[model samples]
Target: MVRIAIDAMGGDLGPRATVRGTVEALAANAELQVRLYGPREALESEFSRLPKRLGADAERLDIVHASSVIAQDMKPSSALRARRDSSLSMMLDEVASGQAAAGVSAGNTGALMALSRRALGTVAGIPRPAISTAVPTQQGGRCYMLDMGANIDASAQRLVEFALMGEVMARRVDGLARPRIALLNVGVEATKGTASVRHADALLKEMANINYVGFVEGDGLFSGTADVVVCDGFVGNIVLKASEGLARMLIERVQATFAAHWGSRVVSLLARPALLRLRRQLDPVRYNGASLLGLSGIVVKSHGRADALGFACAIARAVQEVRIDLPRHLEHELGQRAATAPVALDRRGSGVSPCAKTDDFNS
Candidate 1:
């Protein structure tokens, strides 16, 4: 059975949303187990109030008492340092100790990233772990965008590495055989954007390991020009937030338009089902969150405002990631390339560049 450690004290809804989501996930998958980490009394009290169906499944649920809880406003490093027994810390410990295959938290993003890095460690050759997100594309497929907010300022070399990692993830998670990658840029031409983007583009085009499709502009993001989109954290975060806001605004506009006239109301009555379907298709909660790739173990971070259903989806995503052995696949790909090629030196001449070993560079 796959086991997951959940930060029960995290998120706006606290134990209620966490416990409810866990119960929902358990009900959906009987082979799964959840170990809740939080204040013993608080967890127990929440468990007691669960529906009879879930409360009876308590045998499958375990609790780890964490005397302290980190608040959303608390500084990540300070909260992590001051609260040794916080729920997030305890859950990460379980992951590090191999007690759980993954950890899920709807907590402070920075804290989760910091704690995960400290506890789980980064995969070999990965400079910094990236927060990868899945966005529905206009071509009826999903594209994986990486470094959403994990590393605000990444080197051109690091972005190249992120593209490789993102390709591995998209293939493992989405089963893409030849996942095409595009460096997010201001234009489709090879010459575009800042020095970092242009440099990364040059490197990507020459990297034999990835299916580099040159540049993809912001408009192309949803147009499905690429399977994996790589950009610095600052740009990726802005794009993600903007996409989310745009989706929300469209939903609100549709609602307002329907209420403005009686004929529209009648149309809306007929369109309610379709609108709901579209809403589900674009719901941020349905997407929930993304995995923190480049780590030894699976770690999913959800929005702090996520409700029970959203949290449940995040849990389900983690389960799928574990089932696919994402980390192992990445290790195999990186290792195989390393074994077959001459070591490419970095600026410091330490080792081979990540882009040097792959056999798919564009002429």
Candidate 2:
């Protein structure tokens, strides 16, 4: 049985949403166990509200006591230092200490990243963790996008690491054997993007393992041309939010259009099934988890405002990662990539310059 740690008090609804989600996950997957962390009395109040439909299944869940909560606005580094016993901190500690295989939380993004790095450390050969999640594409399939607001200004080398981690996620979680990757840029031309992206692009193309496609613009994000899109956190976050908002707006518009006039209402009734399908296809709740890839252990970040069903999706994602042993796969992939990829230290002895040779790929 795979056990996952959950921060019951992490999100907006605290234990209310988290507990229901855990129950739902336990009902859906028999092999799953959840260790919920939060204030005992508060969590008990939420537990008492669990639906009777999930009776014996509640046995799969256990709540551990935590003393405090971290505020959403707290600085990431400060949150890490201020509260070792916070629900978020304890949840991460469980996964790091081997008590759980993975951890899920809907807490503050900055604090989660800070605490996770402090607890689990980065996977071998990865400099930092990058947030990644699968987004719906135009071709009826989905593609992974990375650096979705973890590090706002990742270096060229860090972007390469994001690409590598994104590839691993696409393979391990999404079941893609050779997920094509693309760098997010202004245009497809080599000279179109910033120097860092151009540099990372050169390195990616040389990797025999990655199916490195050329650059993809903002419009190509959901074009279904690439299986994984890489970018700095700043751009990735904007695109992610914009895409989600746009999907919601589009779905609302469609719904309104169908209900506007008598004739349209009749047509809508005729196409209700397809419209429902479209609504489900564009629902943000369907994609609730954003993985912090490059951590030594699995950590899933659910949307802060997610409810029961959405939180259940995040729990499901954590379960999937644990079942696949994503960390082990990523570590092994890194070892192989690092072995072939040359690493030259900078003058300050700080980082590996993957693009050391101007003709590294062309050579």
Candidate 3:
């Protein structure tokens, strides 16, 4: 059975959401098992109310006591130094110690990233973990984007690393062979983007493992231009959050349109199936899990305030990663590829530097 560790106390709703999500996930996947980490008494209380809800299937679950919880806004350094007993830390420990295949958390983004890096470390070819999530594309395919918020000031070499890592993930997890990878930039022209992007572009074209497809502008994100998009955390995070906000605003506008009058309501009724499809396509809950790629162990982050179903989706994501054994594929495959790749030149056109050192990055 694939075992997952849940940070039951990590999210906004605590075990109320976590336990229910666990039951929902467990019911769906017979091969799945979970270890919920939180305060012992609190977990017990949550379990007491779930007998009818989960029935005897609750036997598939276990609880591990975690006495503390890292605050939602807690700094990563503070969490690492002081919150070892926190549910988040304990969950990571389970993965690090090989007791669990993966860990899921709806905790502080910074804390989770920091703790995951410290506990699981980085896989070969990845010095630091990058936050990666899939976005719907115009071709009805999922496009993977990375460095969502992990490293704000990512270097040109670092961006190259993200591309390599994202490429491996797309192939292994999504089963894409020779996936089209692109750098998120202002324009498609080689001379249009920043120096770092331009430099990374020059590097990617030479990599044997990646099918680098030049640059993709913001509009290209939904235009089926690339299967994997790479960017620095600052740019990627803004793009992701803006897209989410825009989705919500458009949804509200659609509701207002459908509820405006009897005539509009009639149109809505006739278009119900299409509207439902759109809703499902754009539902934030469906895209709830973001992988902390490049880490040695599997870690999926859920929306901090996600409902039970959304959290369950996050749990399901961890299971998928475990089944694929993503880390091993990345380590062995990318590690071998990096060993033979040419050194990437910096803006100064320097051939080698400490930042581009492949030892730690491709370790």
Candidate 2 wrong stretches, greater than 4 Å: 267-274, 344-363
Clash pairs, candidate 2, are: none
Model 3, CA-based lDDT: 0.81
* Count of residue pairs whose backbone atoms collide, per candidate: 5, 0, 2
TM-score each candidate: 0.90, 0.91, 0.91
lDDT of 3 by residue, 41-138 (tens): 99889878875767667778889999898888666666667758989999999999999999999888888887787788777636666888888887
Regions of candidate 1 where Cα sits further than 4 Å from its true position? 338-363
lDDT, candidate 2, residue 81? 61
TM-score between model 3 and native = 0.91
> Against the true structure, what is every candidate's RMSD?
5.8, 5.8, 4.7
Model 3 residue 208 CA deviation (Å) reads: 1.6
Candidate 1 lDDT over 212-328, as tens digits, reads 898888877788889999988878888888888888899989988997888998988898898988886675433556788877888998766677877888899999998998888
Tens-digit per-residue lDDT, 272-355, candidate 2: 899887876787534568888988899998887778877899999998898898989888887677766655111122122221
Considering every candidate listed, which one attains the maximal lDDT? 3
Candidate 3 backbone clash number: 2
Model 3 stretches with alpha carbons more than 4 Å out: 268-277, 284-286, 345-363
* Candidate structures ordered by lDDT, highest first: 3, 2, 1
